[model samples]
Target: MTRRLLVSYLTLAALVLLCLELPLGYVYSRAERERATNAAHEEAEAIAGYASLTLAYQHPDELSAQVTACAERIGGRVLVVDPAGALLATSHPLDAADQAALADRPEIAAALRGGNGADVRTSSIGGVNWLSVAVPVRHGATLQGAVRLIVPTGAIADDVHQVWLGLALGGAGVLVAVGTVAATLARWIGRPIRELERAARTLAGGSLTTPASVTTGPPEVRVLAATFNRTAALLEHLLASQSAFAGEASHQLKTPLAALRLRLDNLEPDVPPHLRGHLDAAMTETDRLARMVESLLALARMEETALTPEPVDLDRAAKDRVHAWGALYERHGVRLLLLGAPVGRALAVPGAVEQILDNLLSNSLRVAPAGSTVTVFRRLSGISAELHVADQGPGMTAEQRRRAFDRFWRAPDAPKGGTGLGLSLVQRLTLASGGEAVLLEAPGGGLEAVIRLQTLTPRHPGGFPLPLPRRRPMAGSKAGAGVGAG
Candidate 1:
């Protein structure tokens, strides 16, 4: 992780430097060229002025000598060119090879055309970057001739070169500083996360008591750590609860089972018919207690688990489950009716929605009379899509609805045979999906299980859970053991 951070820092700094360097480099190069040309041009203008004075048609010799001396002070050579392109005088080397090289000078030709000119080229005699400039020399209203000057551009090149070197050194220092800071900051930010990751791994490896080492940082990180620590505490408590429950279950369950065994043992000495029946009932009650413990454990497992949820369409999920159980419903003479069409979308965990529907359907199948209707309907209320399962079986009184979502709750009117864990699982799944589940009496005198959920739609995105009916009255009683909401 540290290595990754370093690489990221380095990559970012390089990209910034590359983005900044090229344009500034071009500007520096251009500025250097301009300065060299301007120096030569300034010298040319002075020499041009001196030549104008020499056009005196008198004292031309004196004027020429003055121009040559002025040119020397600035470390350059001057030339006087006639309008006819003839060189009248020059401070250039007068040797044969040097004079012959003067014919190829572009500045000299430009001055003959009555314009100022400047250029940088390798000098044949000096063997260096030579800056040259030419100016149109005039007298009164008539064009007299032109004066040209040459100076070495090595000084300008040296200054620009030094500037470029300084830029290189400065950029290198800045990049290093930036890289150091970036590395430090990335580590500072990433450290707590790394610590948290290690803590989580320890927990995953079955060390739930492992303490998080992240003491402090930003507020958000500290909050996250606090949450982690609290969750760990809760998990430890739950595990302790499970352990305690296991021991209690063993102790409590053995008594009923032992009694049933004793009752059977006594059956060997010519037991009466009624005595046999009582023994059978005792054994049945023991079996029911065992089944209840098992169902309670299943509910506890579902309650303790945390699973990642994905988007699911509750309507589609209900339809598929109903169809799967349709044949069974028909075989039992219960008419399964899907009353309202599915709304096509809901955001829920895939299997969780199906599980919720299964719980509702199972309850409906249990208490529903032969030839009665078990109806499933979808309704849009506010922003929520609701699935309502109504059965013609006896409806719960308001008191029963209030306690219906509680674990191990079996309504008074429900049959006595079922181990109630289905509704508890439904409640857990509803909370997991950011939704709500409730058991209420349908308008048509049967149990109605309503599940409200937020919708996920392209055109209409989501909805809010509305206020449910709060006050519940007492439940009614019935005969025969039936499946009730847990």
Candidate 2:
């Protein structure tokens, strides 16, 4: 954009310089030609004074000498013509063809008819073009003949060429000067806009503190910057308010839910067997409500918290999360397996990797069939690390996976226990940590949740080698687990 702006400014500057310089150059050349012609005319008139006496008295010798002296002074040709348009004397020796042509010249004929005349025509000497001025030599009103002074037009053209060269140099200097100033001005204007673009992108990437600065540029650009700052401020305020409200509402809901669950548990001991099932269902609903509220609270906190990128031991994080859910997996008759070696550190916000893994593992354990393998794995990519949780369960279709990240959106055949916020929370948390979360079809018809995070620079020289962990199936399991090295 700055390049385009600078080019446009230079183009305009060059055009304006051309418009002014071209006509001025032409005018200077024309004036020089006219000055040369007028000077020739004046010289011709002065020579005619001396020639008139010789022509009137029929003295060819004196007239020829005077005409020769005039031609030498002007470095041109001179001729004396009689009233009948016949050449009487010449400045230099000429052939009969040239002498006859001189008498028949247009300006000489006009001069013999008792009139001063001037013309531009080819010279007889070298076939070069010349500006000729002819004046009639009159002795007290009787026209004796004409005296012609001819100067080569090449001299005038030479002078014009020099002047034009100066004009071109001067115009180029002006264009360069103006172009430099225009480029500076373009940078002055474009810098602010470029900065604004960067600030806008940063703000969109969850940094509300970044606002377009109003400084330098035209009045209109400054005004636009001010407007952008105001809009950003408004957006920041609205997001803060929403985050505050979600946190406040979730907290308010959680307290009542916990109190109600405590009261339900207290009533369970006094309840009969027929009503116990209903009470248990009520407790389950309360637990689901509690989980939903916690999820909402987590979402709210994610929006409010600013993520500072940091290096995390993703291998350790995945192993810890999978180990933490080991008891839960045993209760469900599902095999929890940790595959792949421990990967190097991944770049993410604090607690983001843990939260994402926890959500994925919890969801997988809930849906994974009996004796099915629930695998938590780590894979290394170039400058990135991928953490994956694959479950051998009734996985969703492509469309369901796409919409899985939407809050409160569940598949039609989704199990009864989920609040549908697990994947949504995972997605939001991954994005907040400057990572991406995606769902893929695992091998053998299972759903795989993959989180790709940036890898951090190594802390030690040559880096520490990470050893792969062996996969161990659950104790007393009939089916063995599948673990792939990555």
Candidate 3:
């Protein structure tokens, strides 16, 4: 922006200088040429007067001396011709042929015909540019001879060239001055805009304390800064209030819910046999309500917190989680397999990969049937490291998948006891880590929860040794519970 502004200022200034200086230069050049022409005519007339007197007295020597003096004074050639256009006296020597050519010249012929003549042209013999002036010598209406003076135009051109140079130098000096002022003005305008951009990024990064400077730059920018400050302050206040409310609500509700569950459990022993089912149903509802409260609080905290990403070993995290959930899957008569080649480290918020994997595995386990396999694996896809948890279970339709990330939204046929916030939490956590969570159709007809994180290059070569190769199924087991290369 600063560079653009400076260029604009320089362009305008250059155009203005051209518009004002071009015509001025042209006029000065014409005036100098006209002044030179008039001075040459005056000198020719004076020499003609002297030539008239000398010619009447028939003194050729006197005329030659006068022509030489005039030539020295004006730095030009001078010639005196008789009325018949024959050269009589000249300051510069001329051969017979040159003298004949000069006498036949148009200006000299015009002067011998009792008329003054002047012309600026290039000489055909030497190819030199000259301004020629001719004045006739008269002794009381009787023409005696003609005087012609020839001046080189190079001197007049030199003067005009100097004027153009001066104009160019003046224009260059003006541009320098304009550029200096433009640079200062550009910085004045651009600095505030840059500050506003930085402040916006900081706000987006979850810092609401810093505000744009509202006192610099133009009034428009200052107003914009002030508006940004007001908006940021309001947002900061609202988020603070929301965090306070979520914290207070969590504290206020946890104890009452716990007491209610305890009360229902106490009534279990005293309740009659037929009412026992009702008591159990009441306890189940209470537990579901507690889960909902916890889910809500977790979501609120996830939204309010900003986490920076760090490198974590993808293969290690996936294998550890699979090993931890092995017992639970075994109890359900299901196999939990960690498949696919080991992808390297990935960038994710601290502890976020674990949470994301936990939620996905928990959801998969809830719907995975007996004798089925719940597979957790990691693979490298382009620049991303993808962690996938695929379950051999009843998967959601496309529409359900699309809405799954909405807070507390659930499929119509979803299993009971779900808070419907797992996917939402997974998505939030994934995004906070500069990654993404997606629900994809598994290859073998099940829902695959995929978490994609930025791949991180290992700091040192051979940092973590590769995991062991695929292992065979344990003896007497219906399904294998082991890691394998895909």
Candidate 4:
């Protein structure tokens, strides 16, 4: 915009300069030529008087001397020609071969025919241009001869050139001054807009506190900045309130959910043997409720606070998650295989990767049949990192995958004891971390969950060295008490 503004200003300046200078230059040039022509005519008339008197007596020597003296004084050339079309005398000496031709000259011919005339023509001597004037040398009733005065146009041309140079310099200086002012004005107009743009980008990056200063630039720009700052402040306040509400609601609901789960556990024992299966199902439902509440709490916590990214070794995280779920896989007779080479570090928001992996692995382990394989892989390439968990289990259909990320959505034929929030939470957490989560049809007729994130190089040599958490076996542990919800 600033460049465009400057261009517009310069274009106007150039047009104005062109309109003002072009005609003035033409007028000045013509005036200079006319002034030289008038001067040449006056000198020719003066010499013509001397020639007429001298020619009456046919005194060539005396006339030539007077003309030569006048020519030298006025910096011009003078010529005297006779009626018979012969050169009588010249102010300056001329070669005999050059002094003969005179009748064909237009100004001299006119003068010989009893007319006074003037013209601009090139001199024969050295090809320099001259303004020539001719006056008839009359002896009362008869024409004696003609006196011609030729003035070199070098001085007039120099005068016009100086005027042109001055005009050019003045125009250039005006353009430069206008350009400088245009640039300064452009900066003044663009400064506030740049600040607003920067503030917007910072807000997009999850910095809710980025300041948008509103005191500089033009009045309109200042007003715009003020409006933007107010809007951002209001938006931040509203989001903070919403996040607070979600956090408070989730936290408040967890206590009652825990109490309800405990009551279900107590009721499970008192139920009759014939009703034990139904009671166990009821206990399963209660556990699913507990898991749902926990997932909701996690979701609320994530929404409430933005996390700064850090370099995490995805390969190590995958191996650790596999190790943690190892016991459950063995109890279910499912082979948990960690495939592919170790991947480099990835930039992940706090706990985002962990939540994504935990949910995906939990879903994979829940669905994998006996003698089936649940594979966990990590890949690194060109500033990107991906984690994949694939299971040889009943995979989702196209429609199921389409709506899977919607909150609390589940397929009609989905497994029981599920809350239907895992995939949604996974997607939410991944997005929060500035990554993406995708569900794909596994190559071998199973479900594959893939997570992609930006790769980061760790500053330390050990590449974000951290302790791995201990994993308990799934069969006896309370971790896998529910079915896959995603």
Best by TM-score: 3
Lowest lDDT block of 10, candidate 4: 474-483
TM-score for each predicted model, relative to the true structure: 0.51, 0.71, 0.81, 0.80
The clash tally of candidate 3 reads 0
lDDT of 1: 0.72
For model 3, give the RMSD to the true fold. 6.2
Shift in Å, residue 105, candidate 4: 5.3
Tens digit per residue, CA lDDT, model 3, 1-486 = 788988999999999999999999999999999999999999998998888888888888999999999999899999988887788999999888987787688998888887889999998868878999999899998988789999999989999999999999999999999999999999999999999999999888777566999999999999999999899888888887887787678768888999999999888889999998899888888888887778678767776788788989888888888888899999998899888787889898888888787778778777777787778876676677778787766666776778888877877666666777778878988998898888876655567788888887633243443332233322232121111000
lDDT value for model 2: 0.79
Best of the two (1, 4) by TM-score: 4
Q: Which lDDT tens digits does candidate 2 get at residues 1-486?
A: 788988897788778878988999889988988899899999999888888877667787988888888889889989877777677888877787877786687888888877788888874667788888999888998888888888888878888888888888988888789778888888899988987898788777766566676877888888998898888888888888899999999999988998999999899889999898899899988998899999999999888767787888887888788889899889988888888756688788888888787778877776677877888877765555778788777677777777788888777766666787888888887887788998876766667788888777533344443333333333332221111100
lDDT of 3 at 431: 90
**Which should have the higher lDDT, number 2 or number 4?**
2
Once fitted onto the true fold, the runs of candidate 4 whose alpha carbons sit more than 4 angstroms away are 1-15, 41-62, 101-129, 132-148, 205-216, 397-403, 432-434, 457-485
At residue 158, give the lDDT of candidate 4. 90
lDDT tens digits by residue: candidate 4, 129-183: 8888988888788888888888899889899999999999999999999999999
The C-alpha lDDT values of all candidates are 0.72, 0.79, 0.82, 0.78
Candidate 1 at residue 192, lDDT? Answer: 77
Model 2 off-target regions past 4 Å?
1-13, 34-56, 72-233, 457-486
Compared to the true structure, candidate 4 yields what TM-score?
Answer: 0.80
TM-score of 3: 0.81
Give the winner by lDDT: 3 or 4. Answer: 3
Clash counts per candidate, in order, are 7, 0, 0, 1
